[model samples]
Target: MTEHQDAQGQHAPTTPPAEPAVKSAGPSPEMLELAGRMFDAARTGDVDTLEAYIVAGLNPDLQNGKGDTFLTLAAYHDQPAVVEMLIRVGADVEKANDRGQRPLTCATFKGDAASMRLLLAAGADPDAGTPSARQTAQMFGGERVAAVLDEAR
Candidate 1:
């Protein structure tokens, strides 16, 4: 055991007490609720709420456990305005989810021409991700999307 001098010049043992093991409690209810609201805002095209959350320090590119970012959910849900808002707030256009699906690919898969155009205009990579936005458009027979992709390049 080690000893330390006290203010009165007396020596005292410096041994510390043992600490108890602690368990993690994961995210708080408030945090989960906020996350739910954020995801809801993205899927429902609630640009006002989404923008407010982002302005209040929520990440524009915030992703869920499935690796889907706010932009990804908005694009997949055909929410062009929400996608635009996320993009304007600095969300990544080419961020791929755990499934390797980018926002452009999600828009193309859903045959949402407006969202696809929005993503493309924001510099989304047409040839990125697993199937790639171009391949998804071709698979879905989105000739309009293919045309948009061609025009973007």
Candidate 2:
């Protein structure tokens, strides 16, 4: 019997070596470009690029230099669907920009009923402000937003 053999035993089957786990690649220049693209897409309400980026794992609440998030830009531009999408993706609806204007307040000042409705439904505070949403709406003569303010009481 060979030294490799045990009593009445055939050669032991060798265990296969374990494979190491591979990690996903880190962010590259291309990813940075993709983030910038998503930010612009939100500004224009470009649904295709926005959806594509979201599906590809870009965060919906990404902000620009002015601290304006995607949702903020969508509200500012009166893009209701984009606003809804951002809200659905957990964007901070009440986040203030560099000017200290909330998304809802900006929507109110611009007199966008659709955006206002979306923001209100997302629990944005109509009465919460330095220049509050209610006051901004009143200043801009936004009857719909003013009505919203009244209902919040």
Q: Pick the candidate with the highest lDDT.
A: 1
- Candidate lDDT values, in order: 0.89, 0.79
Once fitted onto the true fold, the runs of candidate 2 whose alpha carbons sit more than 4 angstroms away are 1-32
Consecutive 10-residue window with the lowest summed lDDT within model 2:
1-10
Candidate 2 residue 123 C-alpha distance from true site, Å: 0.7
Encode model 1's per-residue lDDT on 19-93: one tens digit a residue.
668767888899989998999889998999989989999888888999999999998999999988888889999
Backbone clashes in model 1: 0
- Listed in order, each prediction's TM-score against the native is 0.83, 0.72
TM-score of candidate 2 on Cα atoms, chains taken together: 0.72
- Number of colliding residue pairs in each model: 0, 0
Candidate 2 lDDT over 1-153, as tens digits, reads: 224555678675555666669766766888768778887888788977797777778776676778788887888888888988878877788888877888888788877778888888889998776687888977884677688666655
Query: Which candidate has the top score in TM-score?
Result: 1
Runs with alpha carbons beyond 4 Å of true place in candidate 1? 1-24
Residue 11 of model 2, lDDT score: 73
